[model samples]
Target: MIACLWARAASRKQRAGRESNREQLTAAGNGSAGPMSKKTLARPARGARGGTRRRHLTVLFTCVGRRVELIQAFRGSAERLDIDLTVVGADKSELAPALHLCDRRAVTPTVLDPGYVSALVEVVRSEGADLLIPLIDHELPVLSQARQRFEESGCLALISDPGVVSTCRDKIATYRHLKKHGIDTPRTWLLEAFAKRKSRSFPCFMKPRRGSASFGNYVIHDDEELHTLGRRVPEPIVQELVAGFEHTLDVYTGLDGIPRCVVPRRRLEVRWGEVSKGQVAKDPRLMEIGRRVAQSLPGCRGVITIQCIMSARGRIRVIEINPRFGGGAPLSILAGADLPGWIMRERLGEKPRIRMDGYTDGIRMLRFDQSVFLDRRGELL
Candidate 1:
């Protein structure tokens, strides 16, 4: 039964692809091949119309924190596909900014809670969500472990393998994995090991072994601060403080776990560990490094964000890897990567044409704050 369903989906994708080709040809013949608008570019090619009459596709985003831009991207993708998309947002708090923007909303248990997985599964079942996208680091491992259970309930969970998630979550594990793949990574030492050695120079960086959003991260310029932070930070790991330009690469791999596209964006300014100002960098060296990193992680699927630094000496050193969409992914999408649209097509069993250099270079993104108002009755204004 599963094979049959997949076969049917593949057939539909082929028909749609052919139709899209024909439309493009028609447009070219009419001498109108300049550039397509966003709406036209997002529209799926016309295909046969007799599967399910009411084609409702629900995508549930779990741990939707401050990803309002990501939610908007998916909403735009659904509009382009002309699908009846009901975006369901789930978070542990009602005050999550993205929650108010969802079509339906639910508050889920924290990932460490014993009932977290069950609560998420219940939301998927009750809302009839067709897909699940996890947005936070801690939830990735949990969701990846429960992926098969969600699949059994006829919902697709967009997550990497549990082992891959584990590696990405732990700084020590990530450093080791990348270094083993012949990738240059910052030298790392556990807090205890560093404390014992006491031989390395100061001005090193330290952070929790398993944390995100730049929490509990510090740069110690002297032995005094190092000792102070070592006692304050939890499970701290010391790493060489890299000096150079930092870049974030947004990479997308297909369901087959093969990387299809990579977008390298240089970080100009960051706030709260999230990119506040960035520019699309079309450097070939950075692109090559991104490709190599994506190809090395065989268990990674969907979107993987890599952080690296290009030193003053002109060598690239990897810093971290997050096996999900990064906070600044919207910048890549706006630069014409169209990742959200590609994800939607892939989820429907369609293969999107790979365009590694599709996005424009030197496109800058400047982010600003927006306000959301609520009434006394707790309703959105």
Candidate 2:
């Protein structure tokens, strides 16, 4: 049964791909980014023989936390354009309450268990979604699988192949792939095996090759620190820390395999595992690096971010590649650069004019409020 379903979904995806190609040609002919306005392409009333039916498009946004905040911001655009945006995550009930602040038409899918790619595909199919947009990093793998399995199922999953997704998922792998592709990246060494009592120099970072949110990351300033962290997490990599001003480069690539917009922001503060405060920077290196990376990952569809460092020597080194919508996406949206909407339009065969560096040229902080409570007691006498 599983095999049958997979086969069926694959067949559907191929058909959708063909249809998408035709739509792209039509959009190009009209010099528009998406379907024509309803008024311009009016259909006869229901039950009329020659009237074309308006296809209802379902856009699925999958993620957690602030990245999910984008669903609210883009709700109006989706509605005005006759697209339904469904937000899916592990906690539907938990997030459903918060979504009330946005368009009431949006819905949160009931994801009983997280990280199950097969289950996620099932939910997407049942929802009749036409597009699957992965908003969080962890969800990328599953989204990639859906793209492969359900290409023609009347839904479009904006993702690259699994091989590319896996290659981009790990920091160590990304470094190697970029280097192999002739793209300059930071020097990194994976510590697969290290004999005890083998002493080395200091000032290296020890963390998992596949990790985010600064989890399990430690800056070892000396030999003692290295040994201590080495004991904590085995088989860790040691790389030269690139110093100087660190910048987060948001690269929104269109369907033509070109970066339509690139926004570089200086990371001012980091709270928990996310960027809390940042500001747009007027650095040409940011755009250069973003373009280079985008060119390298031509198969990578949708939004991608690169965390880079500007060394004192004026050289830029890429720290990591995030292959999905970022947590700080709202900042770019506020600046008039809407990557998500652009992606939606592009997938539907519409070409959008992106205003590169559309955000304000100043500091902006994305802070989320957390509730703190105390127990009531009367023992103060």
Candidate 3:
């Protein structure tokens, strides 16, 4: 009887919270109704008096590369909620495929450039973007550091803390952080330390400390190969290679810094370091690891991709953590994670109910390319 009563109370509280959120959204939209002027781009606009208002939210996606599927997912979510979502895609190249699919498109300077953040801010101001989602790995740290600037302009930047970004960007720091948190990660050695010790095991792995896309990653079977690659790859780090099945976990946390969902995808086939074929796994061990990693990084928000290897003996070792959305996140989304919807709801001041067991297991994704057309004049057709 006590448990039933508690369940009833919780359900009532959830309903009340949702009602409050809806009221707040409606009130804000109504109060801000006005002519669609340049100044009005920064926020949602509502209709005056008893007239209907088209409530809209503008979101900016930076470094959008082959992420058309993700943008479409957001669009689909907005349509379901009756929200006018303006998706603005920004990239360094105008020809990026995803750019053509956005409601508005802009070419921004590279993240390495000093003016990258400023340029992005200007785009946000001009487009009236309410949210900014950085898609690329290298750009994550830069945007994370400038998150406050974006927020100050009425745009929320979905990024982890700068410290977490740094740790994820550098493999050496990533291993240290995981081990520090009592998480199992592969044993790693700095290039200099490995050279000095000369006692490292064979069949080790070497990769750039700050690389992405599986670039500069190699399996070193001997000291000679390690030395050769160490000279070729900059800032190389070696790790004890664990032969096992790899898995990628899509961990989503709310702005309150609490993990709300974890979807572990088993990698079946990888092409160019990106998952070309994968399946969602409901393994409890993987879920627990994802939860622990999420809790470890309290400042993490949105989707964090964790890479781990499970040995034949069932020992799990976390290999990498990317604080941004992974290349294979579309698979998890298709498996019913609804991360895009969750993010939109949370940003609208709605507390999304955590559905840890919402996703389907053994659901597979086989990726293929789709074409976009352009005219000779370089305009999208």
Measured by lDDT, the strongest candidate is 3
Q: Candidate 3 at residue 21, lDDT?
A: 33
lDDT of 2 by residue, 225-289 (tens): 77678677645776667677778888887645577788887788877657888777757778878
Candidate 2 root-mean-square deviation in Å:
13.1
Question: Candidate 3, clashing residue pairs?
Answer: none
Pick by lDDT: 2 or 3, better one? 3
Q: How many backbone clashes does candidate 3 have?
A: 0
Cα miss at 378, model 1 (Å)? 1.3
The residue-by-residue lDDT of candidate 3 on 5-106, one tens digit each, is 323433343344344432211111232333222433243232111235545677889998778777766766666666667777888887788776666667
For model 3, the stretches where C-alpha displacement exceeds 4 angstroms are 1-54
Per-residue lDDT of 16-48 in model 1, one digit per residue for the tens? 434443221111122233332221113222221
Better of 2 and 3 by TM-score: 3
Determine the C-alpha RMSD for candidate 1 after optimal superposition of all C-alphas. Answer: 12.8
Q: What is candidate 1's CA lDDT for residue 56? A: 53
Better of 1 and 2 by lDDT: 1
Score candidate 1 by lDDT.
Answer: 0.77
Q: Give Cα-based local distance difference scores for all models.
A: 0.77, 0.59, 0.79
